[model samples]
Target: MSKIVYFFCFFFCFGIAQAQDDLLKELDSDSIAKSQITAAAFKGLQICTMQSTKLASKGEWYFLVAHRFGDLTEGFDNFFGFDNALTKIGGLYGVTNWLTVGLSRHTLNKNYELTAKYKLANQEEQGFPVTIVGYNTMDINTKLSTDEFPELKGTDRMAFSTQLLISRKITTGFSMEIVPIYIHKNLYEPLSEEVDNFLLAGGGRYKISKRISINAEYALRLNANDSSFYHNPATIGLDIETGGHIFQLVFSNSQAMNDVSYFTNANGISDGKGIYFGFNLYRVF
Candidate 1:
C-alpha cells in the first residue's frame, strides 16, 4: 500500500511539471511570433525625396504637399528664390496593409503622376533581415506643345519609373535604404540620345528625438550621356513629426520632384551653388 501511494504521488507531480513546461514553451513561441512583425523602420512614407519601405494602414488617407524654391543664390532681388518656387500637391490612399496608391500634380512641366507601392517582404520576419518594396510611377507632361513637333503623339509625353526599395534598421534610431531605379521617357531631350535611364539611390535617417530626425538622400545616374547638363541629385533634410502630420525641410540640387525629371533633368550638383530650399508637408486621416 505504501509503494502504491508513493507511485501515484510521483506520477501526479510529474504530470503537473510537464504541463507547466508545455505552457512556458507556448508562451515563448508567442513572444517570438510577435517580435517578428517589426514596426516603424521609418517615420513617414518617404525617407526624403525617395519613398521609404513604409505603407499606410488599411483605409487610411494621406495628403501631401511639396515645394521647391529656385536656387538659393538667386539673390535678394528674387526674394531668395521664393518668387520662383514650384509646388506639388498630391494624395495617397492605403488599399491594404501592404499596398498604397497615390496621385499628384506638379507645377514643373505641368506634370501629372500616378504612383503605386507594394510591400514585398518585412524585416526580422520569417528569418528575413531586410525589408523590400516595389514602386511604380507614371508621369504625363501636360505642358508639351504639339505645335513644336506636329508629329508628336499623345504618348510622346508619357514617362514611367520603376524602383525596388530595400532597407534595414541597423539600430533603434538609425536606418538606411538602397533603391535601384529605372526611368523611361518617351521624349528625350535634344541633347541626349538615350530614352532610358538607370539610377542608384541611397538614403539614411537618424533619429534625434521621438518627433524629429535627420535625413539625407542621393540619386546617382549609372549611365550619363551628357555630364555637363545632367548631374546627380542630392538632398539633406529634417523630418518633424507632430501629432498626425509630418513636416520636412530640406535643401536639394534638384528642382523637379518626379523621378524622371529630377534624375535625368537635374542641372545642379550637390555643391552649394545650385542648391534650393524645399519643404514637404504630409497629413494623415
Candidate 2:
C-alpha cells in the first residue's frame, strides 16, 4: 500500500536526486562532505526547494501509516453515520532534475486502489510555473454479498483518473499548485437513478511557512445528474515536513485520499455538511 496522504509530496522529494552529482561537485569544492550534504539534503524537506540535479548513486524511499475516520451521514440522536478507515504505504524516486516517479496504495472502506504520479514541470520558466501530470486507478476488490455475486467469477471494472497540477512559487518558502483532473469509470450504476461515469475537478496546495502548508481543492461534476461521482468535492489540509519524512494532516469532505476517489468521487453533498473528521499521516523517503 504505497499511496498515502498526498502522493505529490513524496514525488517532490525525488527532484533533489536528479541534481546530486553537480551539487556534489560544486559543494565538495567548497569543503562539504558527501554524507553530510546528503544528510542535510534529506533533512531539508522542511523547506520546499530542490537539493540536486542528477540520479546520484543513492536515491530515496519512504513508507506511510495512515488513519482516516469520517461519516457522510452524521447525527447524534439518530446517529446513522457511515465510517471509513484507511491504511497505506507510499514512496517516490528521482529520475532527473524536476522529474520524478511515484507509487502508492490505499485501503479504505473496503476498497483497494493504486496510484502513480510523474512530475512533468517543477522547475520551469515557460507556460506554467510548476506543472505535474499524473494518474491513478482503483479496483473494487471488496467482498460482495451473495445476492450481488452469487458465484462471483469475473473481475469488476476499475476507476481511472488523471490530473494536471499547475503551481507557482509565491515567495521564499511558500508555493501553491492548482490541479485540474478527469476521471472515468468502466461501469457506474445508482440504486435510485443513473449516474455519470466521469468526473472533472480542480484543487490546490499552499505553503503557509517554512515547515507548514495549506491545501484546498474542489471538484465539479460535468454530468448534471451523476450519482456515481460527487456533486462537489473540496479538501483542506496542512503539510508538515519532518527531516527525512513529510507528514500531512488533512480534512476533506471526501474520505478517499488518493486520486481515484479523492479527486473524482467526492460529491460533498449533505449541504457541504457531509463529514466532520480528519485524514492523518504521510511522508517521503
Candidate 3:
C-alpha cells in the first residue's frame, strides 16, 4: 500500500511540474511575439505641415481638416486674416497595418491630391533604430484654365511629389524626422526655371504634457532658382490632444496648403512678410 501511494504521489508531482514548464514556455513565446513590434512613435499622421511616421491601424479611418488664414499682418481689416482662409479637407484609410491611402482637396489652388504612404521600417524592436516611410502624392490643378494657356493639355495640370520620411523617437518626450522630397510639375509658370524641384525638410516635436506638444518644421528648397519667388517655409505650432481628436495651431511663413504650393509658390517671406495663422484638426475612427 505504501509503495503504491509513493508512486502515485511521484506521478502527480511530475505532471504538475510539466504543466508549469509548458505554461512558462507559452508565456515566453507570447512575450517574444508581442515584443517584436513597437507602437505610437507619433500620435497623429502629421507632425505639423508635414507627414509623420504615424499611420492608422488596419480598418481605421482618419479625417483631416487644415485651414490657413491669410497673413496676420493684414491686421483688423482682414480680421487677423480670418477672412482670407484657405482650407484643405481630406480623409485617410488604413488598408493594412503599414499602408494608408488618402485624398484631399485644397482651396489654395483648387487642387486635389491622391496620396499613399507605406511603412518601410519601424523603429526599435524590429532591429531598426529609426522608422522609415515612403510617401507619394499626385495632385491635379483643377483651376487651370485654357484661357491662360491656349495649348494646355490635361496632363499639364498634373504634379507629383515623392518623399522618404525618416524619423526617430529620441526619448519619450522628443521626436524628430527628416524628409527628402522630389517634386515634379508637368508645367511651370511662364518663364519659371525648373519643372523638377528638390527639397529637404526637417521637423521635430517635444512633449510638454501628456496631451500637449510643441512642434516645429522647415522645408528648404535646394534647387531654387534666382528668379523663383518662393522662400523656405518654416512653422511653429502646438498640438493639443483631446479624446479622439488632435488640434494643431500654427504660425507659418507660407500661406498655401499643398506641398507644391507651400514649397514652391510661397511669396513675401524675404522681408519678414507673409506670416500666417493656421490650424489642423484630425478626427480618428
Candidate 4:
C-alpha cells in the first residue's frame, strides 16, 4: 500500500512539471514571432523621389501634396522658383497592411498617374536582413497633343515604371535603401532619351531627433548616352514630423515628379547648379 501511494504521488508531480515546461515553450515561440520583424526603416512613404519600404496601415487613407519650385539658380529672377512652381496632388489608400494604391496628377507635364505598392517581405531581427517592396506606376501625359505630333496615338502618351525597393534598418536611428528601376515610355526623343531605361537608385536617412531627420538620394542611369542633355538625379532634404503630418523640404536636380521623368531626365547637376527647391506634405486619415 505504501509503495503504491509513493508511485502515484511521483506520477502526479511529473505530469505537472511536464505541463509547465510545455507552457513555457509555447510562450517563447510566441515571443519570437512577435519580435522577429525589425522596426520600420523609414517614417515617410518616400525617401526623396524614390519610394521607401514604409506602408500605411490597413484601412488608412493618405493625402499627399508636393511642390517643386523653379530653379534656384534663377535666384530672384524667378523668385527662387516660386513664380514657376509645379505642384503634385495625390491620395493613397491602404487596401491591406501589405498593399497600397495611389492616384495623382502633376502639373509639370499635365500628367496623371496610377500606382500600386506591395510588400513582398519584411526584415527579420535575426533571420532576413532586408525588407523588400515592389512598386509600379502608369503615367498618362495629357500635355501631349496632335498639334505637337499629328501621328501620336493614345499609347504614345503613356509611360510605365517598375521598381524593386530593398531596405534595411541598420541601427536605431539610421536606415538605408536601394532600388532597381525600369522605365518605359511609348514615345521619347531618340536623340536624348531611350524608350526603355534602367536605373539604380540609393537613398538613406539619419534621425537626429524624434521629429526631424536628414535624407539624401541619388539615381544613376545605367545606359545613358554621353551626348544626352539629361543628368543623373540627386536630392537632399529634411523631414519634419508635425503632430499628425510629415513635411519634407527637398532640393533636387530633377523637377519632374513623375517616376518616368524623375529617374531618366535630370535637368541639373548634383554639384548644386540649377537645383530646384521643393516640399512634400503628407497627411493621414
Candidate 5:
C-alpha cells in the first residue's frame, strides 16, 4: 500500500513538473510587469494550519496532501502517533485570477469539505497596506450514524464557516495576517446548546533564507463554553520550497484540519504534552 501511494505521488509530480515550467514562465512575465503591486506575502497557500492570502493563478491547479498524527505524548508505544495518522487529500482550481475553489476528504470523522476563496483586494507598494480575501467552507460529516443519534437528519451532519483574511507584508522578509471568522454547526455537541461560534485567528511568517521560512498561527475561540473540554488551536511550522513543490513540517495542538473543526473542535491541550506532529505537501500544475 505504501509503495502504491509513493508510485502515485511520483507519477503525477514528475509528469506535472515539466508542464508547470511553461506555465510558470508565462506567469512570471505577467507578474513582473506589475510594478506597483506588492509581491506575495506568503510562499505557500497556507501558513501553518490556516489559509494564507495566496491564491492559485487563473487556470492553475493545485494538489494537496495533509497528515496529522496522533498524540505525540503517547510516546514510542504509539510510535509518536504514526500508527494513528489521519490523512486528507484534495485539489483546488482557479476559476479566474481572483477566484478559487476546492474539495477535500479527511480520514478523521470521514469528513468532506467544499471550499471557495476569492481575492477582494491587493496590497500596493505605496498605497493600500493590506491584502484582503474572503474564504468559506461547508463540511459534511459522513461518519455520523443513525444508530447513535436515532434522529439524525441530513441537516444535522452539516457545518459551515466563513472568514475574512487580512494580510500585510511588513517587510521584505516578514508578513502577518488576521482573520475574523464565523462558524455554525447544525448539530451542537451534547454539552452546549449554542449553535453559533466566533473566532479570531492570527499568524505570521519570517523568511530565514532563500528556500526556508518559519511560520506560526493560533486561533482563539471567543464563545467557547466554560464546561467544554476543548482547547484553542496553535501551531508552528517550517516551510521548505524545493523548486517544484512546497513541504511544510508542523507541530500543532489540534488534529482536526477541516476549517469548521479546526476553529471550533480542537481537543488537544496547549501544553507540550498534547502536541501532534504533522506535515502538509503541495504540488502545482
Candidate 6:
C-alpha cells in the first residue's frame, strides 16, 4: 500500500510539471504576439481597433471577458454540434497609457489557444504615426493521437499557428498591416489537400466620439479550391466603448478563435452559406 501511494504521488507531480511547462511555452508565444500587436502588424496609432490604447496610464490593470456564439446551418443540426459557443478571457496592464500588454485565452468546444499583444503607438495624444509590434499563438488542443481522440480520426492530424505582424496608423483612426504570415493545419477528411494559405488582411477605426468607434477586417485565401471559399473565415466587428471597457458585436463565417480551430477546423456549409452573429466584451483598469 505504501509503495502504491508513492507511485501515485509521483505520477500526479509529473502531470502537474508537464502542465506548467505547457503554460510557460504559451506565455512566451503571447510575448511575441503582443509585440506584433503594438509595433509589428495589426496595430494603429489610434484606439480604433480592439486592442487597448497606447496612451500611457501608468499603474493600471484591465480585464476583458468575451463570448462568441456558434450557430448551426439550416438542417445540419443532426450532423454537427451547431448550437454551442466559445469564450475568451483576457486582461492587460497600462504601464503608461502609450504602452499596453495583455493576454487572451480562447476556449472552444474541444480546442484551446492563447494570444498575447503589446502596444507601440500613441494615437489619442500622439508623438509618431507608426504602429509597430509582433504577435504569436500556441495551439494546445489542435493535435492528438487518434487512439486518444477517436472523434478526430481520419482528420489531417496536426497542430497550427501564425506569427509576425506590424501595422501603421494611416489616419487618426485608420490603420493597416504589412501582410502577416498565415498558418494552417491540414485537418479535414475529404478535403485534406494542402492549401496556399497566405492571406492579406487590414482594418480601421473611425471614432464617432471619445467612446464610440467602427472597426472591421477582411482576408482572402491566396491559393484554395473553389469550394474552400465557403470557409475562408472573414470577419467584421463593431466597437462600443464606455469608461473602462469595450463591447464588440461581430459577424464572421468562422466560429472558432484558436488559430488551429479557426483555420483548419472549420466545418463548411454543406447546404448553403453559413453566417454567424457574435459579440465580445473587453474590460480594463
Q: CA lDDT, every prediction?
A: 0.82, 0.46, 0.81, 0.86, 0.85, 0.50
Off by over 4 Å in 4: 1-35, 270-272
* Between candidates 1 and 6, the lDDT winner: 1
* Model 6 per-residue lDDT tens digits across residues 10-30: 643553355445446646777
Candidate 3 C-alpha lDDT tens digits along 132-154: 77788999999999998899999
Tell me how candidate 3 scores on lDDT.
0.81
For candidate 1, the lDDT comes to 0.82
- RMSD in Å for model 1: 15.9
Q: Which whole-number lDDT from 0 to 100 does residue 190 have in model 4?
A: 91
Model 3 lDDT at residue 122: 64
Better of 2 and 5 by TM-score: 5
lDDT of 3 at 117: 93
- Best candidate per lDDT, number? 4
lDDT, model 1, position 89: 99
Worst 10 residues of 4 by lDDT: 11-20
Q: In candidate 4, what are the lDDT values of residues 1-285, reduced to their tens digit? A: 345335434643553355445446646777535656899999999888778999988999999999999889889998988999999999999999989999999997799999999876677787657787878999999999999899989999899998878899999899999887778899898999987787778999999999999999999887786679999899999999998799999999999888899999888964557789899999999
lDDT of 5 at 114: 98
In model 2, the runs with Cα more than 4 Å from the true position are 1-58, 72-84, 89-105, 125-128, 138-140, 145-147, 150-155, 190-200, 224-229, 267-272
lDDT of 5 by residue, 179-255 (tens): 87778899888584248777779999999999999999999877778888888889999999998698999998888
Of candidate 2, the 10-residue stretch with the lowest lDDT total is: 45-54
Clashing residue pairs in candidate 5 are: none
Better of 3 and 4 by TM-score: 4
Residue range 183-277, candidate 2, lDDT tens digits: 55554545422222333444444556667666555665444353344546666666677665566565667765655555445545566565634
